[model samples]
Target: MSSNGTFTENEEAPTYAPSIPVPNVQELVREDPSQVPQRYVRDMEDRPKDTDMSHLSSLIPLIDFSLLLLGNKEELNKLDLACQDWGFFQVVNHGVAKEVLQKMKDVAAEFFELPLEEKNKNAMPSDDIQGYGHIYVISEEQILDWSDALMLAVHPSHYRKLKFWPKSPTGLQEIIEEYSNAIRKFGTELLESFSLIMGMEKEALLGLHKQLIQAYRVNYYPPCSKPDQVLGVSPHSDSSTITILMQDDDVCGLQIKHDDDWVPVNTIPDALVVKVGDVIEMWSNGKYKSIEHRAVVNDERARISYASFLYPHDEVEIEPLIDPKTEQLIYKKVKYGDYLRNSMKTKMEGKAHTHVAKVETLA
Candidate 1:
């Protein structure tokens, strides 16, 4: 990795084998919103069951970034509990300008609403994962998600493949680049807070990388007739250290597992949902957890979510930060690039890749 966070050619950047081309899911739903094709249908056991969270009577913990910035101890403790108990939290009043956020959302909506041909102009090449396409489709027999997406490399502007970005949606390119910086700043600030809570120097976590790498996964899930029969995204833990997701403002589709029950996460106006991912769990030596989460579709409306994934440089190793309380490390070191490639090559079935780093113990 270069000092600017770009993966240079000689660096061990993960290579993705070309995925078998999939049908344009958005187009399929327009012809008939009623039945999904067999490839898109999840098995009876895999389909979503009753996941309503009415029984839990609680939403994920909400943290006010304003208070954390003010160094309020009470709010800091809430941050600690949110990481430990849920491995997820909703952040409100995060300082990024509302207009920047709104514009990014508008462009994403406009881009997805374009005709399939116009959108496909930037179809993901047989050799790469970025551009107008979905990922994790390594096999023809894999169960498909009922979604269409335009994934992109948004940070380290020089590292981008501009040819894959949509040109029809004028300014779509500019807003994404601007918004990337805002999100990068936001993620870094939150990591500083997490470092304080972990009893480490504020730069401890930040010091792990030469430059942080960031990317965006903009998702579009069309309405389904049998909403319970297909997932918008499969159940899996994120491969990033922390992923900040801007949920669909009005629709609720994300669910995280808690206490043996799948709990639906409800968005509060503009609050962004923060997910603790596999790398965070590894570095924290499991003091904080990375939990499995999935997205589902509804019977009536399409859903759009813009998620920003934060990562250390590809060459950096995720060494477990020894927990003072435990006085030992539980996770062995794993290079980020290797872990990332493993997670992207196959279907997500939980935190499968993260387990590869756990130290073995014999009876």
Candidate 2:
């Protein structure tokens, strides 16, 4: 993938395929529980353990889209608090038809269910990060996640590479395109709402005519023999302005770091998870944090999620949009292209990369 986020096919195959064939975790767990590779195991310190949930009784806020459209004051207040305090929320009664959501889930499951060799046809090139493959795998000794992902650009349709898209899953392309269009429109509305919540004009932070770029990640977290030791995705905040996630209804693995504890985000029927990304934090001048979150694998069932990220055009320059009464500019102006290039060089673990963009202040 280029700095502009376009993917090009490289004829050469990657030289870094694992020495041992990567076992299909979904099938292997159903047959033999102990076949999990040592590389997939986590150290004792990184394992998941039973934690107290009683203190986390207050679930993340769920904002009704109808209320947002109606401009209800109370609902708008909730949206503000959710962004300012939690940086994550569930949007219920969202306009996307139930049929569209179901079809997206169905197609995603169907695509991942294909045989490993069949799925490899869409494998990403060694240099491109926008197809079926693992990401951020820098070394053989690094711990691997118990997941597989298919990533592709959805918006600015010209950036899409149809060859990486699955043709076997009947109607996959049509449904995904329809779904992507709907989400792109809805995501724009949400960004406008964010500006209003910040007491600015609807398009103050985000420009009036700025074109947003959308990318999709279809994540497949297969069942793991040692669920406690492996994570589906490592902890990291998104690099986009906002991310809308369509999670598997029957699975529960998405967790958010809250006040030193990892709390599970319960799935709300027909609701999409809205996340504040690093760009938003910079835009807000550090007033709202980009939450740290991760996904864990299930012991018996596989998990799937589709995340749509809304980003600014590559040429856009990002600068802190500070509100005189509340915020002071904390980050310097930088081009989106430069930021992305610098970010790609670092590991996606925590908010360290975001911190790099911050301006140091002296006492």
Candidate 3:
């Protein structure tokens, strides 16, 4: 089957699928702890360690949704400052039902617990980005993260390939649909709020697109014997307009780069983590920043996180909006599709594709 869950039209049936076989990290660690792959290990400089977290308390701002919903001026100012200065924040009482939130996390964990063969049924094709599989595997020698993920396009319901969706977990489809819809609504509301925070007419930023591109990614990070040596996800900024993350409440592994140190993000119960992506930075004309973040594996417990990425429609032309008061334009106009492709290519290489969109000026 193809990555999109469609049958391939090959003239002759191949002995094996074109995709590489990924071992179940959870199973491997249980069977033989000593057999951990060497490729998962990182160098000394890349390993995670305990550091002084005195300044962390002020780094990540937490905002109250009740205040945002009521249009409280003080809270709105705080939101604007968080976007401008920190580029990351946690939102409480965002209106998503607690039942739905718990079910979303439960379904994700259940799907990953399925047998290896069943899970591999949705394995992504080498050429495609959707379905269950490893990402950023460009070469044989490239280091692999001790993680697995299931990714799918959720918006524009017609774009969904239902065959790739899991069936073993009863009610998985229904819960996921409900959760995605709630997230979509929340995202639109947040975008409008952002417009207000930016001093533009409400919906000024959101009204540019007729349709929004939304995708869901469920990440499963298995416990590693040498947690310090392996990363669950590499350091990189997202390529979307905004990314909403549902972190694992019981386990902590998410961290963001603050200055020269990596500070852990403390998980707040029933709260969602918001991240500013590269596209937003471009649209804001560099007024907002897309910060770099990474995930590390837990030594004893597995970690699961759900992230929904909001993007401009494929054909949308993204550029810095005109501001009469502004002295110069920092970014150039570019098609969303072109930027996405370039971003994917450079993502694994530890380079920010958004840098290419910067316009040069004589010093």
Candidate 4:
């Protein structure tokens, strides 16, 4: 694969793109509410079970990253509790600059606001999933999310697809790369804390994910005329080891399933939401949790979000560190690359995830 003594990066995974183009929901929602398509509408059971969790929203965990970095053991304990109980928390005093956050948000808002044809300049290719498209659209008849996004591989520079990067909004590319670099160190330090909480060396988890993979998905959820009848995104858990989320500062839609209830996530100024994903759950031998979560739509305005997903190298094995004394080996060990590709295939076939069996303890 050498060209003039220079190596080129090929697509890392096989083709798992959607079978068809996703409709421009941002434009479609502008139609009258009575004529809204059945495709985006949801049955009663699938809609939110409750939206009155405003009071409980503030109950979600809030951790101060600076305190944790100062070797405050109590903050580490809180991180452990947040992982085990809520699977989601907001981090304040995080090292990322407010300017970086605002710039990323500004460029994203400007990108989605561009003309439809202009925005589709980076429409997702049928052979790949990294571009402006809906990642969950699997079939012709499958129900679709009320949102669209631009997905990109941000780290391991060689693996990046430059063509998928947007063209206009002059600073979009630079701002994205800047924000990506800004968060890289924080994500690494956060994982180190996980290792300490697991009673292992701070570098233990870091060692397991050399050449860590990071990707960003900038999402745009348009206002729906019949908001309660549709969903912004389905209730699915992320596959990343950990996801650092930049939620909409002006609107709220992200919700997590907790305590047999769907609780709204209240936004905190200058804080980012950190989520425990399936990879962390398996790696911890189920010590941590990856709770199911989704996005809800509203009638008045659009909701925008940014998610930076971190993962282990492709060849690494997802072997759980079981407590030999109390817990039995549960999750099947598999290559990170294979597991990720298979999950994509399952989604392409419009199937519910059957992988990652429930991690359990021995009686």
Candidate 5:
């Protein structure tokens, strides 16, 4: 990784191998929408065509958290401003080793390249909750994403007993275990920092997530000859509390919604792109913005990336970022399950931020 934040832009990066076919838009529409559940279809249906690619002032926002983590209030405020405005940032010196990230990416690629039948065996049936393979319309009624992904729910109790993984990649579990621990540790530190930034107790948010749910998604984007014709993943905010992504150093296709256009974001070699998810935004009473982003499959090559979601325990009470004395609506209190179900049903395109009526929770 370069010491300078900006790298000499590689104008001609090559794509990856073994083309994965993408169905045309008509074909996708013809398929049952229930097969591709995502949260936010109602809002998306109302959005204009121009909403997809509006241009933002800046394409990439980088935040160096070392200063802020050291208790520099000013630096932390500055960083928060960037996040609120830009929604995404490249973090450096945030603790995770570059080698660990590379190894994760390597294992992810190996997992995707295994024989299709083997990959299909782990596929998410419409009904199955846990295990190996991809889940089509896992959200509820969202459109199919151009990418194929495997999801795993691994908490401390189930960390060593992973049920879904490719056998061909002999050491996939070992590689993932190490990477997961590193990420979990890093996430804890970040959560503490976030708590401090919000003028709360250092362990304020961490304590709320007693059974913190951690999920890992291995995403594979096959080469698409027509890059502009379709998207790898639609523009949507993460439903989790935080999303930590490890992208391939070789191929670039991640984009975020800026101003109005979907601006391309180049992944800095060895650096992770961290985003504040909708859950955090809701908890913050909308103080923080959950930026919208999507994956664009490379027309020239196949791409592989790993995304780790740091979520709260299922029963955690999420409220607005207001003090009790204020009595103001900082945010409506909602159960995590309701939010998750709503998010899953809508297509991934910026659905997480859709403001739906709050559901009352029973004691």
Candidate 6:
């Protein structure tokens, strides 16, 4: 398996097999709502057409020219509304240069193409530091996501030691380092906008910033012999606060659940999809939602994606929305570390996550 999570050769393609059913929305909602919470479910009873994306081209908010170039509270609210209600949206002219975006895609492709022996040298040995290569090996968490990934925890400046990076790219390593730094700057700016919309101090999310860890997962989905028989990754919601994904231009494997229907998220040039994750969902008291999404591979070509995860320090406490009242609190306060541990434990046992509890809660 050459870091693509599957063996690749120019040889004859092997027959494909279907993957067992991945946990889906109806099944999730079928569980006790209090135990397995998702805002999309509760709203579905009163509104029947919430998930339809057929006419979504118009329905999906086209961010205005001004909001795309300049940031404002009102614009942030618009973005937040789309996130809360739609769970996914695309933005263009978002400031990051087109060349920079291409570099990220190219470098990720090059990294995955490296020989397996060289790539494994950078494999993560422990789950703690978010090193590099395949964290899912020991994931012991839900079913394994089919793709192989590289993880980088970049933050606080000091934690970004070169040891955690691969030596192959040589100068390319420096380029990635710069890229991560730039993304952090942009991530903070986006978070600031989100904070303002949530009615919190512009810097309210700053303390949790210390533990701000930036993770990059370079995932490769090899062309499956049986493309329709199996999935590249299963359906799952992100556990962090936010995720910025840069998809390869040629692949059309990304999809998201909308109004009880699955809509394809075709990657657009110069567009980045910002996904709201669990922590932000909880912090917003369900005001903002963490939507479930997945990736599927094609039999014709391989696919790659650069997914960057932004998370708070382990000790940071996740509480209700900044407001005292918001649709009645959906969850109790918990630490990010606790949620991670619970996810790991349940995943190891092959169980779908419900509460995403903090271990300390058990204590």
Per lDDT, the best of the predicted structures is 1
Worst 10-residue lDDT window, candidate 6: 13-22
Error of 2 at 119 (Å): 0.9
lDDT of 4: 0.81
Q: What would the per-residue lDDT of candidate 5 be over residues 137-242, giving only the tens digit for each residue?
A: 4333444556667776655434322445555577887787789888888888888878887788988888777556677887777665444445677778887888
Task: Estimate every model's Cα lDDT from 0 to 1.
Answer: 0.83, 0.77, 0.79, 0.81, 0.65, 0.61
Q: Give the TM-score of candidate 6.
A: 0.76
Each candidate's root-mean-square deviation in Å? 2.5, 4.8, 6.0, 3.7, 11.0, 12.6
State the weakest 10-residue window (summed lDDT) of model 3: 10-19
Q: 1 or 6, which is superior by TM-score?
A: 1
TM-score for model 2?
0.89
Q: TM-score for each prediction? A: 0.93, 0.89, 0.90, 0.91, 0.78, 0.76
In model 5, state the lDDT of residue 24. 31
Error of 5 at 113 (Å): 1.2
lDDT of 4 by residue, 145-238 (tens): 8888899988878777888899878999999999998888899999989899988899888778755788899999988878888888888777
> Which pairs clash in model 2?
1-128
lDDT of 5: 0.65
Best by TM-score: 1
> Between the candidate structures 3 and 5, which one is better when assessed by lDDT?
3
The true-versus-predicted C-alpha distance at residue 324 of model 2, in Å, is: 7.6
Candidates ranked by lDDT:
1, 4, 3, 2, 5, 6
